[model samples]
Target: MKTVPIQIALPEDEYADQLAFLKKWDDGPKPPGWELTPKAVVVFICGGSGLRLENNQRMDIAPKFIGDRSLVERCVVTLAGARGLLLVGEPGTAKSMLSELLSAAICGTSALTVQGSAGTTEDQLRYGWNYGMLLAEGPSEKALVPSPVLSAMRAGKVARIEEITRCQPEIQDSLVPVLSERRIAVPELGDYSVPAREGFCVIATANLRDRGVSEMSAALKRRFNFEHVDPIADKKAEVALVKSRTQRAIADAQALIDVDDAVVDTLVTIFKDLRSGITEEGWSVAKPTTVMSTAEAVAISTSISLAAAYFPDSGAQLALIPGHILGAVRKDDEKDTERIIAYFDKAIQRRANANPNSPWAILWDNRHGIS
Candidate 1:
């Protein structure tokens, strides 16, 4: 019998070629246990656009985090020091993506991670019991279940914790001693301690609007250097991201849909208007409480392409963006639907009338199904 194998590689494993290219280019001293120099790491996150090689060949490194290079620099430097790095932001601001990119660049493996949630147990963060081994060998080292945090501590690798605030505050504080003391105390095994090797650090994310989140304790807060990850502020940049991501999705699905540039622009404009409670032309539109993020824009853009792919001859009517956004906005508050409706009447329709035969007008025409 023949068996098939599944290959699931981390970002580092997948991008070995780029990593090798960067290693060859950079000669700066790296911190202990880092895979790339600080400059090279920066290049890895913020693309080395139009960068020159040793042979004078142009090299283009694809950027992961579409924000400030200095912010990325600060994050990398934080993990190189004593304090743990905490990424705080609104949902879909690429906090997790930034963390994974940082982890892959620094540790050579982005696999050591703990996803924090309301149901996350203390054992998940620290250690757990192997009941079978415990029953056989009475509280021995063999009976201990090592967690991601413990594994990183022992190996001196980067460990990630997603949605840290979602975890109960008491459960979250379990890291105070582990971080400050640089060790995990396992009392069940005769006060066993797992000392953190050099370069071991924690990168955690806290969503501003996460459900059932407890306020982080002051002591725990002191142990981490917090960085705010804001959404993309530029329109062209956001549109480019949406197009790139949606095109990738279309290719993955083997869909031959070309998401129009005009459609992409209109969708992004709607999101920005709804998010800021004001139009590009200075109209006061009521803001929706729902997060109208760039990630959401990418998702909606991809979804629209997929819709075009599946539905026969649906490419002609690619302006049902209002309908798609209607679903996206009504998440947190039902009253947000009214705000969306008001936006159609006040801003979008006016734009359609003002800029006749454009995608805005087409989207305005499709506003009927939004309700």
Candidate 2:
């Protein structure tokens, strides 16, 4: 069974449902050519409940990123004002997802995107010539291959640049003029240029934690409004996100949805503990080397449930394997082993001891062998 990428874009029928899920945007003015008002886009991206589509159907577009609605609101407003929107955050914080959802909702397509990397050249963000056509026709318009940004500009839609910081500063600065002047110049063919249409905009995402990231210049930054996305923090919100994500994962994995509530709680606890460096009981645990992101938690929980369903002994009890948890927590760093072990011994072990039949007790007893 092939799994499809989760569709973040809401169908027109689902637009109002999506609005209902987001916060009510009371912002002053809206951008041109937006499907929803700037305020509605904010509400759709962040978790809020005041929007409605013309159709009487109750739409249900879930808030994908569990962060502050205000932050999302600012991003929408920035795009509404035709300023570039830069989403900067740690890895796996859903920066790209948020950007994709925003672009898809705003422009009706998320496919017009540039994935930035160290090898990415100016041609990627700007325009490239089709070498075959260029050789045949000598730099005619037919030879010009417009990049995603140029296409978006001509079409008056949002263009997405993923991992903008991963591109070299030189490649990134190519957008300074496109953003500021709202046009791309092609000097090779008689100074041909594509001026942006009314609704044209750019949404770029960068990982702040990447080691080789090139900082955005102040001049370039001035062309955009930056939004920092934090990881999901509230327990109830995190649980809801995990549950929603796990359902999607299970559907994608083609696995049975036989996971237990206790198992969900346990996975959430591990994520919260490792992410925040404290247990649910407020016991401090050393930070692990791994990121402990909500995304990872959803993956681990889904994997455990699938393993239990397919494998013999593991499948019967629906019990989480300590080995799976250990593998999830103790990634990349040797020191993480000690941190995970400490967490299990001091926090999980203590809790399981108080309630002998606790679902985590099996995990607590088997932690050593698994690690």
Candidate 3:
């Protein structure tokens, strides 16, 4: 028998499988044009009790991200009001993931998104011209091309603008009237305007460390609720997230390997300590000037797992972690390697001496990657 791997589905598709269950679980009050009640939306993100399928079997849902349940609820509420929701945080903290999840749950589709960048133009947020048609027909409605935001407005669905701060201030402000008057005027198309529908809303994400992010104008800022997404705080939860996500990635790659929990723990520890500027032994290690987010931990863990899967019997290959850490820590600056070496000297060496039998200590013994 041939093993046919399952195709990865979108978040909306995943939730669609449970849409009936969501409706049955809470048929209470819902906002206009919402797929589920606000209460059920809460259950969708934070996970909940009492859901079943038509087969009379219990249906359990997993909470997507580990964060404050109240935070997710606030996002849902903001969308219900058809206002803008802005998620700002350091890179790799899952700000985009949160937006996608909320959009998937409420609107049932998260595909209407515009990736904001320095080169992003106002036409992307408002409307663009079908130049061929414009030249032939002389700027009629047929020549107007709607942007993702315009489409979301016309459809009354969620419109996601990722890394909004990366866009120029003038381009970013193109969204002001969209959120304020809930409309987009296409002057070139001869008095045509696109009005947002009942469920129309926008979700945007920005990185705190972004240098090219021209400060959002006060007019744009006043139109949206800003949420600061922090990095994973709990050590145990962070470890579990990395382990589970890395395992999923490995399995998705169709590679068979059991990434030792001890290895996962050490990786998470180093990332958290470096990110927090403190060591497990409370030693002050020089922090790398990089955004050491949990996503980076997942990447390093998955890479190690893939390597172990391919070279199960290679002892040296299994101990190549220090090399991997050295690589993961140095993103943009060569000086970051010095921070890792200094950390190895002050913290890793001390910790290894304290716990000589642990997996972390084994990793510490391989610190010559920097030397």
Candidate 4:
């Protein structure tokens, strides 16, 4: 039997070629322990058009994050200066994805990461001990187990802390000394300490929705430069991104049907309207409690596309839009189901009335999916 490949690849592995290309593409001075110059790193995330090598080979860098280039630049600048960078944003706005891309481009790997949660202990962010080794040989260097942050300090690479606010306040505060002093003191080793290498820095992400869950102390907040990531504001750009990503997802799944662009456009419009509580036509709509982010839109599009591919005779792809929207909206709150139905009764129904033959009409007709 043929072996199955992994479903998802890390940023470092997925963008290995692009990272290598950027490294050779720019020979400019880079900060200590950085693989790419700050300029190249920005381009790697924001993308560049018409880039060429000495051989005149055209290599266009694809845009990974669909947000402000300025924000990405600020992040690079912070890391370049050896300061911690905190990216705070609404859920599903690709904050964690941006962190991974930056780490992969700066170093050669994005695996040095600590996922923050309520159960996260200080040892996960600092260091732990190997009980076996500790018991057998007493507290020694060999008995010490370094966390991802410690590993990054030793390797002079970027380390990521995802959902930093999800961790307990006290546990989160453990990073204060590490970020400020740039060293992890090991009392077990008798005054020994692991100083952060020249390139070592941190990139942490926190969701605005998680504010009350585990608020960071003022001292911890002061240690990092905060950047607020917002949702994509341009409709055309978001639609294009959703279509591109959905098509790519279908291709990755080896699906047989082509993605319906009209379906994707309609789906994204609904998401934007629900997300912003306002329609493109200047109509007011009740926003769902759940985040109707572009990432969610892409997932719904991919699901609808794959459904069409697998069940070709079920119905037209456009007909699947309302059901998927209902599914996406009903995730966080049960009342959101009523909100979605009202949206269908208002914005979608109006669109259907405006043009009875358009995709909106199909969505309006299938509005019963919400109920």
Candidate whose lDDT is highest = 4
| Each candidate: RMSD | 2.0, 3.7, 2.5, 1.3
Clashes of 3: 0
For this target, which candidate reaches the highest TM-score against the unseen true structure? 4
lDDT of each: 0.86, 0.77, 0.84, 0.90
Please give the lDDT score for candidate 2: 0.77
TM-score of each: 0.95, 0.88, 0.94, 0.97
lDDT of 4 by residue, 1-371 (tens): 99989888998898888888888889999999999999999998999989888888778887999888999999999999888999998988899889999999999888999999889999999999999989999999888999999999999999899999999999999899899999999987989999999889999999998754236799998998999999999889899899999988998999988879898789888888888899999999999899988899999999999998998898989988877887787887899988988888999899999999999989888877778
Clashes found in each candidate (C-alpha, N, C closer than 3 A): 0, 7, 0, 0
TM-score of 3: 0.94
lDDT by residue (221-322, candidate 2, tens digit) is 888788888888788888877777777777767777565667777778778887888777888889887787877877877877777657747443324556
Comparison by TM-score, 1 against 3, better one:
1
Evaluated at residue 70, the lDDT of candidate 1 is 92
Please provide, for model 3 over 193-235, each residue's C-alpha lDDT reduced to its tens digit, 9 standing for 90 to 100. Answer: 8888888889999999884334889999999998889998899
lDDT of 1 by residue, 81-136 (tens): 75799999999999999998899988887899999988999999999999998888
- Segments in model 4 whose C-alpha atoms lie over 4 Å from true places: 212-214
| lDDT for 362 (candidate 4) | 90
Task: List the candidate numbers ranked by TM-score, top first.
Answer: 4, 1, 3, 2
